[model samples]
Target: MPCRPSFSSGFDGTSDQDAAMEAADPRGSESDGTWEELRLLKPREVRHLIWEQVPLVDASSSQEYLRHHLPGALHLPHGARLQQLRNVLPDLSQPLILYSNAQNRAAALARRLSNLDYANVYVLGGGIGILLALQDA
Candidate 1:
């Protein structure tokens, strides 16, 4: 007789209970290569982080940034003087969250920061609209 696959078996051959346990746990990837602990936070969480003094860098253009932005967010428009970044943000180790109206600009700035050896850099998902909504809420 041929052996048959069990209903509880996952792609990696782990049982459903094992996968569930891994998903419930928070540490790192399980057999599926999915992050166990990572989660996309809401705008309120971003706001709370900002209020807690986390450094935020707005990668939008000067006009856009000046029009409206998080009260204390540092404006570092992409392709501006990189030296300005060094001057304004002397501590490269700080938790820096970069954001813009869209993902391209923010991702570009994040890449630049990463190349410049910023250790704790992150890009905000959903951008300013999310933050605005959170504020409205």
Candidate 2:
């Protein structure tokens, strides 16, 4: 898919210090005490691991997800119930990665997944936007 020229990246003008701090503390502004075990991955890192067949879940809004997402990504918007996610993902122990328009949203959901007993959960650090950028580059 062609990159959307006007895509809303959802990135506020935070300083590099702020971004670093957020990375250091995954909970950051969306702290809910459930992300301590969740892993964060860069776009290139994900690309390298594609051969492992890790499932990618798009936690972005349905509209944005449909517009552009990694190949083979499954949609599971952040607002969906944990039960809904569980239904789509039957194997709780399977390793999976989730991404959204921004890090916070996917991180939040990754936390939920971790809390839901999905033992191997990860989030794309800068969300689908960064992955898209990596592909375009």
Candidate 3:
């Protein structure tokens, strides 16, 4: 969609330091004891993978999701019942991004997903709001 933000990261090669810096940024996620694997992707980075058919989940309730959400995002309720997520997401190794309005619920889901062995779960940093602003820009 035209709303896709331009990816400054550009899916290009990066140095090991770049990786370390990204990992060190505590803004996106907290250490959850399971390898600290949840990544927080900015709108631009998320846009880079938008066209790649990466799976995205809207961790908001169904009602909230129906009001607005990413075009291809799946609706997976958060907390205690994330097995539904496991059933929907078959591979633990594939890249996955989860988002809600401001990422509160999304963060919880990301941590749980990581705990469940999904190694590549990422939270949309500012959620759909940032995506909208980027699209407008």
RMSD to the true structure for each prediction, in A, is 16.5, 7.1, 6.0
State the C-alpha lDDT per candidate: 0.61, 0.69, 0.70
Model 1 lDDT on a 0 to 1 scale: 0.61
**Candidate 2 residue 50 C-alpha distance from true site, Å:** 2.0
lDDT tens readout by residue for model 2, 1-137: 42222322443434343354346555555566455566887655565455467777888888887787777777888678788768877999988888888777788788788777899888877666665654344
* Shift of residue 128 alpha carbon in model 2, Å: 1.3
Predicted model with the maximum lDDT: 3
102 Cα displacement, candidate 2 (Å): 1.1
Clashes of each: 0, 0, 0
Candidate 3 ranges with C-alpha deviation above 4 Å: 1-37
- For model 1 the local lDDT of residue 49 reads 68
lDDT at position 64, candidate 2: 86
Compose the digit string of candidate 1's lDDT tens values, residues 1-137.
32211222122323333344334333343565332212323344555566567877788988888887776777889787767887988788888777787534776777777778877776665566555643343
Q: How does model 3 fare in lDDT?
A: 0.70
Worst window of 10 by summed lDDT in candidate 2:
2-11
